[model samples]
Target: MDERDHASLPEGTHELSSEVSERVRSVISAAEAAANAVRHEAEQSAQVRGRIAEEEAIRIVDEAKGEADAYLAERRRRISELSDTVVERAEKIVARLDRAEEVRRQLQGLADSLGESAEELAAQLRDQPPPSVPQAAEAAPPVEQAAVAEPEAPEAPPGEEPPTGESEPPGGPEVVQLAEAPAEAGPAEAQAGDDRHEADEQLSARLVALQMAVAGGNRGDVEVHLRETFGIEDPVAILDDVFGPGTDAEKRVAWPRTGDSAA
Candidate 1:
């Protein structure tokens, strides 16, 4: 080999240093291996941390969704309960109002009936004639004739003579003569009847005043009041007596004869 070639030759080759080169190579390889191991461990740790974070996030979301669903369900239940309570209370109020109206109508009808009764009583008192005294002699004839018609007692059978002051037969009904009442009333009795008549007239006048007040200004209302007061069953008959047929008052007070007219 030429000197120049020898000079260009690598120094380590000229020194024949295989062991040194091997040692240097081993040191470099060790450093590269350690660096690679560190990199691999760091990547694994990062992957594990990312997985844990993702699982935690998913679990948190699931818990939040469950809480939201429960809250919503409770809210809906409360709303339903409140709505039912309000509706129930409103129904009770409406029912009470209806009952009150019905009672008012019934009271009005009762007042109308009482007024009618008073009017009828007034009309009867106005129409009735004063009572007259009965004649005494004319009332006594029938009573006197009845006492004289008894037959004579039949003679006791042949063997039996009638015992003096004998009692009537056993089991036979005893005859009793009732004494007739005097035909003529005393002055005191006649005066008492007059007083009763006067009191009746006063009562009738008071009833008439009550009827007028209840009936107000309406003629039909007054007639209705009168019929109810006197227990008059027939509206037409009361109307006929108070106001003759074909009169306006009669037409107003008379009951309809048929369903068609009533309608």
Candidate 2:
């Protein structure tokens, strides 16, 4: 009821019934307790939700930190690999430079050796007399003469007997054994003739060499020929052996084949 209705009632004549007031109070108390229980339950639900949200936020933060650390590690490893690669490339370049320097040094040594050889040859040429020009009358190239081979005798008919009597034989030694042939020359004359023939051969060989040297039209021609003919390996060492001591004083240009080194 309204407050006005309660104010209009006389104090003693309008008192509420005890049983009704008791029932009303019990109902009000029960409703208040129920409302309190609902509020407490709502507060507990809000606290549980808050705790879950906080735990979830913490977990997300931890996950993000772990990912960040892994990414940094990966980047650091890649940087280290790049550094190693750069160092390796630099080392390779250095190695190549070193090899190039070594090759250049070897080339310089070769050049020096060639220069020394050329100097020696120049000295020898200065000391030695120039080769004489070949005469036009004897311009035909020298013909190397070998030992004259004896002619073989004609064979007799297959059935006929060979000439058994003293007859002029084919070879020089055989002819000397025959009675009809003149006796062989004395040892002294034969030796003199041999000496003359040897001297002529030497002169002929020297002239041919001179002709060849002139034909090539270069100072190195003779050196090349000497190396090829005598099998001299080192270009520098061959100079000493070719220009002997006191060789400049020699008048005759004798062809020397003492070691049989000539081709």
lDDT of each: 0.59, 0.54
Q: For candidate 2, which ten residues in a row score worst on lDDT?
A: 139-148
Q: Clashes per prediction?
A: 6, 0
lDDT of 2 by residue, 4-98 (tens): 97778777645555567888999999999999999999999999999999999999999999999999999999999999998998788666666
Candidate that scores best on lDDT: 1
Residue clash pairs of candidate 2? none
Q: For model 1, how does the per-residue alpha-carbon lDDT over 1-263 read when each residue is reduced to its tens digit?
A: 68898789898777766678788999999999999999999999999999999999999999999999999999999999999998897677666556655664564566566556655666776687666655556555654554446455778888886866556443222222222244445445667877876666445534443435333433455456556654444444434443455455423322212232323
Residue 103 in model 2: lDDT: 67
In model 1, the clashing pairs are 115-225, 116-225, 116-226, 116-229, 117-229, 117-230
Error of 2 at 55 (Å): 0.8
